[model samples]
Target: MFGLGAYRRWLRSDRVRLGRWGERRARAFLRRRGYRIIARNWRCPAGEVDLVAADPSGPIAFVEVKTRRDEHWAPGQQAVHERKQQHLARVAQWFARRYGLKDRSLRFDVIVVVVPETGRVEVRHYPSAFRPPC
Candidate 1:
Protein backbone atom coordinates (compact mmCIF):
# COMPACT_ATOMS: atom_id res chain seq x y z
CA MET A 1 0.00 0.00 0.00
CA PHE A 2 3.05 2.28 0.25
CA GLY A 3 3.94 4.71 -2.50
CA LEU A 4 7.23 4.53 -4.42
CA GLY A 5 8.97 7.20 -2.36
CA ALA A 6 7.73 5.70 0.88
CA TYR A 7 8.94 2.24 -0.17
CA ARG A 8 12.37 3.61 -1.05
CA ARG A 9 12.66 5.40 2.26
CA TRP A 10 11.59 2.31 4.17
CA LEU A 11 14.16 0.23 2.37
CA ARG A 12 16.91 2.72 3.08
CA SER A 13 16.03 2.85 6.77
CA ASP A 14 15.88 -0.90 6.97
CA ARG A 15 19.29 -1.17 5.39
CA VAL A 16 20.70 1.30 7.86
CA ARG A 17 19.31 -0.64 10.74
CA LEU A 18 20.75 -3.85 9.39
CA GLY A 19 24.12 -2.22 8.85
CA ARG A 20 24.21 -0.96 12.43
CA TRP A 21 23.34 -4.38 13.79
CA GLY A 22 26.04 -5.96 11.66
CA GLU A 23 28.58 -3.45 12.90
CA ARG A 24 27.74 -4.36 16.46
CA ARG A 25 28.18 -8.02 15.68
CA ALA A 26 31.45 -7.35 13.92
CA ARG A 27 32.69 -5.39 16.94
CA ALA A 28 31.92 -8.25 19.27
CA PHE A 29 33.60 -10.71 16.92
CA LEU A 30 36.71 -8.55 16.73
CA ARG A 31 36.84 -8.17 20.49
CA ARG A 32 36.63 -11.91 20.89
CA ARG A 33 39.63 -12.16 18.55
CA GLY A 34 41.61 -9.61 20.64
CA TYR A 35 41.24 -6.62 18.42
CA ARG A 36 40.72 -3.42 20.40
CA ILE A 37 38.00 -1.24 18.99
CA ILE A 38 39.04 2.37 18.65
CA ALA A 39 36.10 3.92 16.85
CA ARG A 40 32.78 3.14 15.28
CA ASN A 41 31.26 5.00 12.35
CA TRP A 42 34.16 7.39 12.01
CA ARG A 43 33.41 10.01 9.39
CA CYS A 44 35.31 12.80 7.67
CA PRO A 45 35.25 14.80 4.45
CA ALA A 46 36.35 11.81 2.39
CA GLY A 47 33.88 9.20 3.67
CA GLU A 48 32.90 7.01 6.59
CA VAL A 49 34.50 3.88 8.03
CA ASP A 50 32.28 1.40 9.82
CA LEU A 51 34.82 0.36 12.41
CA VAL A 52 38.42 1.08 13.34
CA ALA A 53 40.33 -1.30 15.55
CA ALA A 54 43.86 -2.12 16.60
CA ASP A 55 45.22 -5.62 16.39
CA PRO A 56 47.15 -6.78 19.45
CA SER A 57 50.37 -7.27 17.49
CA GLY A 58 49.73 -5.83 14.05
CA PRO A 59 48.73 -2.67 12.23
CA ILE A 60 45.69 -0.53 12.91
CA ALA A 61 42.69 -1.73 10.93
CA PHE A 62 40.25 0.35 8.97
CA VAL A 63 37.29 -1.96 8.68
CA GLU A 64 34.58 -1.77 6.07
CA VAL A 65 31.47 -3.65 7.11
CA LYS A 66 29.04 -4.92 4.47
CA THR A 67 25.77 -6.35 5.69
CA ARG A 68 23.24 -8.30 3.68
CA ARG A 69 20.25 -10.56 3.86
CA ASP A 70 20.72 -14.16 2.64
CA GLU A 71 23.44 -13.14 0.15
CA HIS A 72 22.66 -15.91 -2.32
CA TRP A 73 23.82 -13.91 -5.31
CA ALA A 74 26.97 -12.13 -4.12
CA PRO A 75 28.80 -11.96 -0.83
CA GLY A 76 28.73 -8.68 1.04
CA GLN A 77 32.49 -8.21 0.84
CA GLN A 78 32.26 -8.07 -2.92
CA ALA A 79 30.43 -4.79 -2.45
CA VAL A 80 33.66 -3.20 -1.31
CA HIS A 81 35.00 -2.66 -4.79
CA GLU A 82 37.98 -0.73 -6.08
CA ARG A 83 36.31 2.66 -5.91
CA LYS A 84 35.20 1.99 -2.38
CA GLN A 85 38.73 0.92 -1.46
CA GLN A 86 40.10 4.17 -2.84
CA HIS A 87 37.50 6.09 -0.87
CA LEU A 88 38.39 4.31 2.35
CA ALA A 89 42.07 4.92 1.71
CA ARG A 90 41.44 8.62 1.61
CA VAL A 91 39.42 8.50 4.81
CA ALA A 92 42.14 6.44 6.50
CA GLN A 93 44.73 9.02 5.59
CA TRP A 94 42.59 11.78 7.03
CA PHE A 95 41.98 9.78 10.20
CA ALA A 96 45.69 9.04 10.62
CA ARG A 97 46.66 12.67 10.21
CA ARG A 98 44.02 13.84 12.65
CA TYR A 99 44.93 11.23 15.25
CA GLY A 100 48.70 11.54 14.84
CA LEU A 101 49.04 7.96 13.65
CA LYS A 102 50.73 8.73 10.35
CA ASP A 103 53.89 6.73 11.10
CA ARG A 104 52.09 3.64 12.31
CA SER A 105 51.22 0.80 9.98
CA LEU A 106 47.69 0.79 8.59
CA ARG A 107 45.57 -1.95 7.08
CA PHE A 108 42.25 -2.20 5.26
CA ASP A 109 39.87 -4.90 6.37
CA VAL A 110 36.44 -6.07 5.23
CA ILE A 111 33.86 -7.78 7.41
CA VAL A 112 30.90 -9.35 5.67
CA VAL A 113 27.84 -10.09 7.77
CA VAL A 114 24.97 -12.13 6.43
CA VAL A 115 21.74 -12.12 8.39
CA PRO A 116 19.04 -14.40 7.16
CA GLU A 117 15.48 -13.85 8.27
CA THR A 118 15.05 -17.48 9.28
CA GLY A 119 18.58 -18.77 9.69
CA ARG A 120 21.67 -18.14 11.75
CA VAL A 121 23.80 -15.05 11.28
CA GLU A 122 27.12 -15.39 9.47
CA VAL A 123 30.26 -13.30 9.61
CA ARG A 124 33.38 -13.45 7.45
CA HIS A 125 36.47 -11.43 8.15
CA TYR A 126 39.09 -10.46 5.60
CA PRO A 127 42.18 -8.87 7.08
CA SER A 128 44.46 -6.73 5.00
CA ALA A 129 41.99 -7.13 2.23
CA PHE A 130 43.41 -4.38 0.07
CA ARG A 131 46.29 -1.95 -0.09
CA PRO A 132 46.03 1.73 -0.83
CA PRO A 133 47.46 3.10 -3.99
CA CYS A 134 50.78 4.90 -3.72
Candidate 2:
Protein backbone atom coordinates (compact mmCIF):
# COMPACT_ATOMS: atom_id res chain seq x y z
CA MET A 1 0.00 0.00 0.00
CA PHE A 2 2.78 2.37 0.87
CA GLY A 3 4.61 1.63 -2.37
CA LEU A 4 1.47 2.21 -4.41
CA GLY A 5 0.79 5.52 -2.69
CA ALA A 6 4.31 6.68 -3.31
CA TYR A 7 4.06 5.70 -6.95
CA ARG A 8 0.83 7.60 -7.32
CA ARG A 9 2.37 10.72 -5.84
CA TRP A 10 5.32 10.40 -8.15
CA LEU A 11 3.02 10.11 -11.13
CA ARG A 12 1.14 13.24 -10.12
CA SER A 13 4.38 15.17 -9.79
CA ASP A 14 5.54 13.99 -13.18
CA ARG A 15 2.28 15.06 -14.76
CA VAL A 16 2.59 18.55 -13.32
CA ARG A 17 6.18 18.86 -14.54
CA LEU A 18 5.20 17.73 -17.99
CA GLY A 19 2.31 20.20 -18.07
CA ARG A 20 4.58 23.09 -17.16
CA TRP A 21 7.11 22.04 -19.76
CA GLY A 22 4.38 21.78 -22.36
CA GLU A 23 3.17 25.32 -21.53
CA ARG A 24 6.67 26.63 -22.08
CA ARG A 25 6.89 24.84 -25.41
CA ALA A 26 3.49 26.20 -26.41
CA ARG A 27 4.60 29.77 -25.67
CA ALA A 28 7.71 29.27 -27.79
CA PHE A 29 5.64 27.78 -30.57
CA LEU A 30 3.32 30.80 -30.62
CA ARG A 31 6.24 33.21 -30.69
CA ARG A 32 7.70 31.37 -33.65
CA ARG A 33 4.38 31.65 -35.46
CA GLY A 34 4.71 35.44 -35.67
CA TYR A 35 2.58 36.29 -32.68
CA ARG A 36 4.05 39.09 -30.60
CA ILE A 37 3.67 37.92 -27.03
CA ILE A 38 2.36 40.82 -24.98
CA ALA A 39 1.75 39.09 -21.65
CA ARG A 40 2.20 35.69 -20.08
CA ASN A 41 0.25 34.34 -17.13
CA TRP A 42 -1.62 37.57 -16.95
CA ARG A 43 -4.02 37.98 -14.05
CA CYS A 44 -6.95 40.33 -13.63
CA PRO A 45 -9.91 40.59 -11.32
CA ALA A 46 -11.98 38.84 -13.96
CA GLY A 47 -9.68 35.89 -14.50
CA GLU A 48 -6.40 34.85 -16.05
CA VAL A 49 -5.19 34.65 -19.60
CA ASP A 50 -2.29 32.34 -20.19
CA LEU A 51 -0.90 34.47 -22.94
CA VAL A 52 -1.80 37.63 -24.77
CA ALA A 53 -0.40 38.41 -28.19
CA ALA A 54 -0.91 40.52 -31.25
CA ASP A 55 -1.03 39.67 -34.92
CA PRO A 56 -0.30 41.91 -37.84
CA SER A 57 -3.94 41.62 -38.84
CA GLY A 58 -4.75 44.06 -36.02
CA PRO A 59 -6.36 41.67 -33.59
CA ILE A 60 -5.14 41.58 -30.02
CA ALA A 61 -5.33 37.88 -29.25
CA PHE A 62 -6.26 36.49 -25.84
CA VAL A 63 -4.90 32.98 -25.65
CA GLU A 64 -5.59 30.07 -23.33
CA VAL A 65 -3.15 27.22 -23.31
CA LYS A 66 -4.00 23.72 -22.08
CA THR A 67 -1.31 21.10 -21.70
CA ARG A 68 -1.84 17.41 -21.10
CA ARG A 69 0.02 14.17 -21.46
CA ASP A 70 -2.75 12.77 -23.61
CA GLU A 71 -6.34 13.32 -24.65
CA HIS A 72 -7.88 11.11 -22.01
CA TRP A 73 -11.12 12.99 -21.29
CA ALA A 74 -11.43 15.04 -24.43
CA PRO A 75 -9.38 17.48 -26.45
CA GLY A 76 -7.89 20.29 -24.43
CA GLN A 77 -10.20 22.73 -26.16
CA GLN A 78 -13.09 21.14 -24.31
CA ALA A 79 -11.60 22.19 -21.03
CA VAL A 80 -12.68 25.79 -21.51
CA HIS A 81 -16.13 25.63 -20.00
CA GLU A 82 -18.78 28.30 -20.50
CA ARG A 83 -18.08 29.89 -17.13
CA LYS A 84 -14.42 29.89 -17.93
CA GLN A 85 -15.17 31.48 -21.27
CA GLN A 86 -17.19 34.19 -19.65
CA HIS A 87 -14.45 34.94 -17.19
CA LEU A 88 -11.84 35.00 -19.92
CA ALA A 89 -13.88 37.36 -21.99
CA ARG A 90 -14.33 39.68 -19.08
CA VAL A 91 -10.64 39.58 -18.35
CA ALA A 92 -9.85 40.27 -21.98
CA GLN A 93 -12.11 43.27 -21.88
CA TRP A 94 -10.42 44.53 -18.75
CA PHE A 95 -7.07 44.03 -20.39
CA ALA A 96 -8.11 45.99 -23.45
CA ARG A 97 -9.70 48.90 -21.62
CA ARG A 98 -6.89 49.04 -19.09
CA TYR A 99 -4.34 49.40 -21.86
CA GLY A 100 -6.51 51.69 -23.99
CA LEU A 101 -6.96 48.91 -26.52
CA LYS A 102 -10.72 49.35 -26.80
CA ASP A 103 -10.38 50.43 -30.42
CA ARG A 104 -8.21 47.49 -31.37
CA SER A 105 -9.64 44.35 -32.89
CA LEU A 106 -9.86 41.46 -30.46
CA ARG A 107 -9.84 37.68 -30.72
CA PHE A 108 -9.89 34.72 -28.37
CA ASP A 109 -7.55 31.85 -29.12
CA VAL A 110 -6.81 28.48 -27.56
CA ILE A 111 -3.62 26.48 -27.80
CA VAL A 112 -3.48 22.82 -26.87
CA VAL A 113 -0.18 21.13 -26.20
CA VAL A 114 -0.04 17.36 -26.14
CA VAL A 115 3.07 15.71 -24.86
CA PRO A 116 3.23 12.23 -26.30
CA GLU A 117 4.90 9.27 -24.67
CA THR A 118 7.90 9.71 -26.92
CA GLY A 119 8.27 13.21 -25.39
CA ARG A 120 7.34 14.97 -28.62
CA VAL A 121 5.25 18.10 -28.24
CA GLU A 122 2.24 18.61 -30.47
CA VAL A 123 0.79 22.09 -30.54
CA ARG A 124 -2.53 23.15 -31.98
CA HIS A 125 -3.58 26.76 -32.17
CA TYR A 126 -7.26 27.57 -32.52
CA PRO A 127 -7.82 31.12 -33.63
CA SER A 128 -10.99 32.99 -32.67
CA ALA A 129 -12.21 30.08 -30.65
CA PHE A 130 -14.80 32.03 -28.67
CA ARG A 131 -16.43 35.42 -28.71
CA PRO A 132 -17.31 37.71 -25.85
CA PRO A 133 -20.91 37.51 -24.75
CA CYS A 134 -23.01 40.51 -25.50
Candidate 3:
Protein backbone atom coordinates (compact mmCIF):
# COMPACT_ATOMS: atom_id res chain seq x y z
CA MET A 1 0.00 0.00 0.00
CA PHE A 2 1.28 3.44 -0.83
CA GLY A 3 1.49 6.02 1.92
CA LEU A 4 -0.31 9.32 1.45
CA GLY A 5 2.93 11.28 1.17
CA ALA A 6 4.34 8.91 -1.40
CA TYR A 7 1.17 9.06 -3.43
CA ARG A 8 1.29 12.86 -3.31
CA ARG A 9 4.88 12.86 -4.49
CA TRP A 10 4.05 10.53 -7.35
CA LEU A 11 1.17 12.74 -8.38
CA ARG A 12 3.33 15.82 -8.28
CA SER A 13 6.01 14.19 -10.37
CA ASP A 14 3.48 12.98 -12.88
CA ARG A 15 2.06 16.44 -13.23
CA VAL A 16 5.52 17.87 -13.71
CA ARG A 17 6.20 15.41 -16.46
CA LEU A 18 2.96 16.27 -18.16
CA GLY A 19 3.76 19.97 -17.91
CA ARG A 20 7.19 19.50 -19.43
CA TRP A 21 5.75 17.49 -22.29
CA GLY A 22 3.11 20.09 -22.87
CA GLU A 23 5.68 22.88 -22.86
CA ARG A 24 7.65 21.08 -25.52
CA ARG A 25 4.58 20.80 -27.69
CA ALA A 26 3.80 24.43 -27.10
CA ARG A 27 7.32 25.42 -28.08
CA ALA A 28 7.08 23.49 -31.31
CA PHE A 29 3.76 25.05 -32.09
CA LEU A 30 5.18 28.52 -31.53
CA ARG A 31 8.28 27.79 -33.56
CA ARG A 32 6.20 26.68 -36.52
CA ARG A 33 4.39 29.99 -36.30
CA GLY A 34 7.59 32.04 -36.40
CA TYR A 35 8.04 32.91 -32.73
CA ARG A 36 11.58 32.95 -31.46
CA ILE A 37 11.69 31.21 -28.11
CA ILE A 38 13.50 33.34 -25.55
CA ALA A 39 13.07 31.25 -22.42
CA ARG A 40 11.36 28.19 -21.05
CA ASN A 41 9.99 27.83 -17.56
CA TRP A 42 11.30 31.22 -16.54
CA ARG A 43 10.85 32.05 -12.86
CA CYS A 44 10.93 35.14 -10.72
CA PRO A 45 10.05 36.25 -7.20
CA ALA A 46 6.47 36.71 -8.29
CA GLY A 47 5.94 33.41 -10.06
CA GLU A 48 6.83 31.35 -13.15
CA VAL A 49 6.14 32.03 -16.80
CA ASP A 50 6.09 28.89 -18.94
CA LEU A 51 7.50 30.25 -22.18
CA VAL A 52 8.74 33.61 -23.41
CA ALA A 53 8.88 34.27 -27.14
CA ALA A 54 9.53 37.14 -29.49
CA ASP A 55 6.85 37.26 -32.14
CA PRO A 56 7.94 38.20 -35.63
CA SER A 57 7.70 41.96 -35.85
CA GLY A 58 5.27 41.90 -33.00
CA PRO A 59 5.13 42.15 -29.23
CA ILE A 60 7.04 39.86 -26.95
CA ALA A 61 4.78 37.02 -25.82
CA PHE A 62 4.70 35.67 -22.29
CA VAL A 63 3.10 32.27 -22.58
CA GLU A 64 1.34 30.16 -20.02
CA VAL A 65 0.93 26.50 -20.85
CA LYS A 66 -1.75 24.21 -19.43
CA THR A 67 -1.69 20.47 -19.96
CA ARG A 68 -4.53 18.08 -19.39
CA ARG A 69 -5.33 14.50 -20.13
CA ASP A 70 -8.77 15.33 -21.41
CA GLU A 71 -11.17 18.23 -21.79
CA HIS A 72 -14.15 16.61 -20.12
CA TRP A 73 -13.67 18.61 -16.97
CA ALA A 74 -12.91 21.87 -18.74
CA PRO A 75 -10.76 23.32 -21.47
CA GLY A 76 -7.21 23.87 -20.28
CA GLN A 77 -7.36 27.55 -21.15
CA GLN A 78 -10.20 27.99 -18.68
CA ALA A 79 -7.77 27.07 -15.95
CA VAL A 80 -6.03 30.37 -16.51
CA HIS A 81 -8.39 32.42 -14.43
CA GLU A 82 -8.09 35.96 -13.18
CA ARG A 83 -5.76 35.15 -10.27
CA LYS A 84 -3.53 33.14 -12.58
CA GLN A 85 -3.39 36.01 -15.02
CA GLN A 86 -2.37 38.34 -12.24
CA HIS A 87 0.37 35.96 -11.19
CA LEU A 88 1.62 35.72 -14.77
CA ALA A 89 1.50 39.49 -15.10
CA ARG A 90 3.65 39.94 -12.04
CA VAL A 91 6.17 37.46 -13.36
CA ALA A 92 6.18 39.14 -16.77
CA GLN A 93 6.77 42.52 -15.19
CA TRP A 94 9.73 41.19 -13.24
CA PHE A 95 11.16 39.52 -16.34
CA ALA A 96 10.72 42.63 -18.47
CA ARG A 97 12.47 44.81 -15.92
CA ARG A 98 15.30 42.33 -15.50
CA TYR A 99 15.85 42.10 -19.25
CA GLY A 100 15.49 45.83 -19.95
CA LEU A 101 12.39 45.19 -22.08
CA LYS A 102 10.22 47.76 -20.38
CA ASP A 103 9.99 49.90 -23.49
CA ARG A 104 9.10 47.02 -25.77
CA SER A 105 5.58 45.85 -26.40
CA LEU A 106 4.51 42.78 -24.41
CA ARG A 107 1.48 40.53 -24.38
CA PHE A 108 0.24 37.48 -22.53
CA ASP A 109 -0.65 34.25 -24.29
CA VAL A 110 -2.06 30.88 -23.26
CA ILE A 111 -1.33 27.51 -24.83
CA VAL A 112 -3.49 24.57 -23.95
CA VAL A 113 -2.43 21.03 -24.75
CA VAL A 114 -4.82 18.11 -24.44
CA VAL A 115 -3.41 14.62 -24.67
CA PRO A 116 -6.07 11.97 -24.86
CA GLU A 117 -5.90 8.19 -24.75
CA THR A 118 -6.21 7.90 -28.53
CA GLY A 119 -2.60 9.07 -29.05
CA ARG A 120 -3.63 12.32 -30.65
CA VAL A 121 -2.70 15.68 -29.10
CA GLU A 122 -4.51 18.97 -29.43
CA VAL A 123 -2.90 22.35 -29.03
CA ARG A 124 -4.81 25.58 -28.81
CA HIS A 125 -3.09 28.92 -28.60
CA TYR A 126 -4.75 32.09 -27.41
CA PRO A 127 -2.90 35.25 -28.33
CA SER A 128 -3.44 38.26 -26.13
CA ALA A 129 -5.34 36.06 -23.75
CA PHE A 130 -5.84 38.83 -21.27
CA ARG A 131 -4.63 42.23 -20.19
CA PRO A 132 -3.22 42.76 -16.74
CA PRO A 133 -5.58 44.59 -14.49
CA CYS A 134 -4.18 47.92 -13.42
Candidate 4:
Protein backbone atom coordinates (compact mmCIF):
# COMPACT_ATOMS: atom_id res chain seq x y z
CA MET A 1 0.00 0.00 0.00
CA PHE A 2 1.04 3.65 -0.57
CA GLY A 3 1.33 6.40 2.02
CA LEU A 4 -1.07 9.35 2.23
CA GLY A 5 1.56 11.80 1.07
CA ALA A 6 2.19 9.91 -2.15
CA TYR A 7 -1.53 9.59 -2.82
CA ARG A 8 -2.07 13.32 -2.22
CA ARG A 9 0.79 14.22 -4.48
CA TRP A 10 -0.57 12.02 -7.19
CA LEU A 11 -3.90 13.73 -6.91
CA ARG A 12 -2.44 17.20 -7.10
CA SER A 13 0.42 16.99 -9.54
CA ASP A 14 -0.57 14.25 -11.94
CA ARG A 15 -4.13 15.46 -12.25
CA VAL A 16 -3.09 19.05 -12.72
CA ARG A 17 -0.58 18.14 -15.37
CA LEU A 18 -3.19 16.20 -17.24
CA GLY A 19 -5.56 19.14 -16.99
CA ARG A 20 -3.03 21.62 -18.27
CA TRP A 21 -2.20 19.33 -21.16
CA GLY A 22 -5.88 19.07 -21.95
CA GLU A 23 -6.22 22.83 -21.98
CA ARG A 24 -3.50 23.04 -24.55
CA ARG A 25 -5.24 20.44 -26.68
CA ALA A 26 -8.49 22.34 -26.27
CA ARG A 27 -6.90 25.53 -27.51
CA ALA A 28 -5.54 23.81 -30.58
CA PHE A 29 -8.89 22.22 -31.24
CA LEU A 30 -10.62 25.56 -30.90
CA ARG A 31 -8.21 27.15 -33.31
CA ARG A 32 -8.78 24.39 -35.87
CA ARG A 33 -12.52 24.87 -35.41
CA GLY A 34 -12.09 28.56 -36.22
CA TYR A 35 -12.84 30.09 -32.84
CA ARG A 36 -10.98 33.27 -32.04
CA ILE A 37 -9.37 32.82 -28.66
CA ILE A 38 -9.73 35.88 -26.46
CA ALA A 39 -8.46 34.75 -23.09
CA ARG A 40 -7.38 31.66 -21.25
CA ASN A 41 -7.49 30.86 -17.56
CA TRP A 42 -9.27 34.15 -17.05
CA ARG A 43 -9.76 34.62 -13.33
CA CYS A 44 -11.38 36.99 -10.90
CA PRO A 45 -12.73 36.97 -7.34
CA ALA A 46 -15.95 35.36 -8.47
CA GLY A 47 -14.41 32.45 -10.38
CA GLU A 48 -12.26 31.41 -13.31
CA VAL A 49 -13.13 30.86 -16.94
CA ASP A 50 -11.16 28.30 -18.87
CA LEU A 51 -11.50 30.03 -22.22
CA VAL A 52 -13.19 33.12 -23.56
CA ALA A 53 -13.61 33.14 -27.32
CA ALA A 54 -15.82 34.05 -30.23
CA ASP A 55 -17.14 32.22 -33.24
CA PRO A 56 -16.81 33.65 -36.71
CA SER A 57 -19.11 36.64 -36.70
CA GLY A 58 -21.04 35.11 -33.87
CA PRO A 59 -21.60 35.14 -30.14
CA ILE A 60 -18.98 35.39 -27.47
CA ALA A 61 -18.38 31.93 -26.00
CA PHE A 62 -17.52 31.31 -22.38
CA VAL A 63 -15.95 27.86 -22.48
CA GLU A 64 -15.18 25.34 -19.81
CA VAL A 65 -12.72 22.59 -20.60
CA LYS A 66 -12.58 19.27 -18.74
CA THR A 67 -9.77 16.79 -19.09
CA ARG A 68 -9.59 13.25 -17.77
CA ARG A 69 -7.35 10.26 -18.05
CA ASP A 70 -10.30 8.37 -19.38
CA GLU A 71 -14.08 8.20 -19.42
CA HIS A 72 -14.19 5.59 -16.66
CA TRP A 73 -13.92 8.18 -13.92
CA ALA A 74 -16.93 10.18 -15.13
CA PRO A 75 -18.19 11.91 -18.21
CA GLY A 76 -16.54 15.30 -18.31
CA GLN A 77 -19.71 17.04 -19.39
CA GLN A 78 -21.55 15.73 -16.34
CA ALA A 79 -19.15 17.55 -14.05
CA VAL A 80 -20.55 20.90 -15.08
CA HIS A 81 -23.54 20.81 -12.78
CA GLU A 82 -25.92 23.60 -12.00
CA ARG A 83 -23.62 25.17 -9.48
CA LYS A 84 -20.72 25.10 -11.91
CA GLN A 85 -22.84 26.55 -14.69
CA GLN A 86 -23.97 29.35 -12.44
CA HIS A 87 -20.40 30.09 -11.46
CA LEU A 88 -19.38 30.16 -15.12
CA ALA A 89 -22.27 32.50 -15.88
CA ARG A 90 -21.14 34.89 -13.20
CA VAL A 91 -17.60 34.90 -14.54
CA ALA A 92 -18.73 35.19 -18.14
CA GLN A 93 -20.86 38.20 -17.31
CA TRP A 94 -17.98 39.84 -15.55
CA PHE A 95 -15.72 39.25 -18.55
CA ALA A 96 -18.30 40.60 -20.97
CA ARG A 97 -18.97 43.75 -19.03
CA ARG A 98 -15.32 44.40 -18.42
CA TYR A 99 -14.52 44.01 -22.11
CA GLY A 100 -17.39 46.19 -23.26
CA LEU A 101 -19.19 43.13 -24.71
CA LYS A 102 -22.33 43.39 -22.67
CA ASP A 103 -24.34 44.29 -25.74
CA ARG A 104 -23.03 41.38 -27.81
CA SER A 105 -24.41 37.86 -27.95
CA LEU A 106 -23.26 35.39 -25.35
CA ARG A 107 -23.07 31.61 -24.96
CA PHE A 108 -21.61 28.91 -22.74
CA ASP A 109 -19.62 26.06 -24.19
CA VAL A 110 -18.10 22.82 -22.92
CA ILE A 111 -15.09 21.07 -24.32
CA VAL A 112 -14.19 17.59 -23.10
CA VAL A 113 -10.76 16.13 -23.66
CA VAL A 114 -9.97 12.54 -22.85
CA VAL A 115 -6.36 11.39 -22.69
CA PRO A 116 -5.83 7.73 -22.12
CA GLU A 117 -2.93 6.25 -20.22
CA THR A 118 -1.08 5.80 -23.49
CA GLY A 119 -3.36 6.38 -26.42
CA ARG A 120 -4.85 9.01 -28.68
CA VAL A 121 -6.56 12.12 -27.33
CA GLU A 122 -10.24 12.72 -27.77
CA VAL A 123 -11.87 16.14 -27.92
CA ARG A 124 -15.55 16.99 -28.01
CA HIS A 125 -17.03 20.45 -28.19
CA TYR A 126 -20.51 21.39 -27.14
CA PRO A 127 -21.49 24.84 -28.27
CA SER A 128 -24.28 26.69 -26.52
CA ALA A 129 -23.92 24.09 -23.84
CA PHE A 130 -25.75 26.04 -21.12
CA ARG A 131 -27.52 29.29 -20.43
CA PRO A 132 -27.14 31.59 -17.48
CA PRO A 133 -29.58 30.93 -14.69
CA CYS A 134 -32.35 33.46 -14.33
Candidate 1 total steric clashes? 0
Ranking of models by lDDT: 3, 1, 4, 2
Q: What is the C-alpha lDDT of each candidate?
A: 0.93, 0.86, 0.94, 0.90
Candidate 4, 1-134: lDDT as tens digits: 87999899988998889888989999999999898999999998889999998888689888899998888968999899999999998898789878999789999999999988888889999999887777
lDDT score for candidate 2 against the true structure: 0.86
The residue-by-residue lDDT of candidate 1 on 5-124, one tens digit each, is 999999999989988999999999999999999999999999899999999987899999988898888888788888998999999999999999978999999999888988799899
Instruction: Evaluate model 1: give its TM-score.
Output: 0.95
Worst 10 residues of 2 by lDDT: 18-27
lDDT agreement of model 3 with the native: 0.94
Name the candidate that leads on lDDT. Answer: 3
Across 7-119, the per-residue lDDT of candidate 3 in tens digits comes to: 99999999999999999999999999999999998988998899999999779999999999999998988898889999999999999999999889999999999999997
lDDT for 111 in candidate 1 is: 95
Backbone clashes for every candidate come to 0, 0, 0, 0
Candidate 2 backbone clash number: 0
How far residue 82's Cα lies from its native spot in candidate 1, in Å, is 0.7
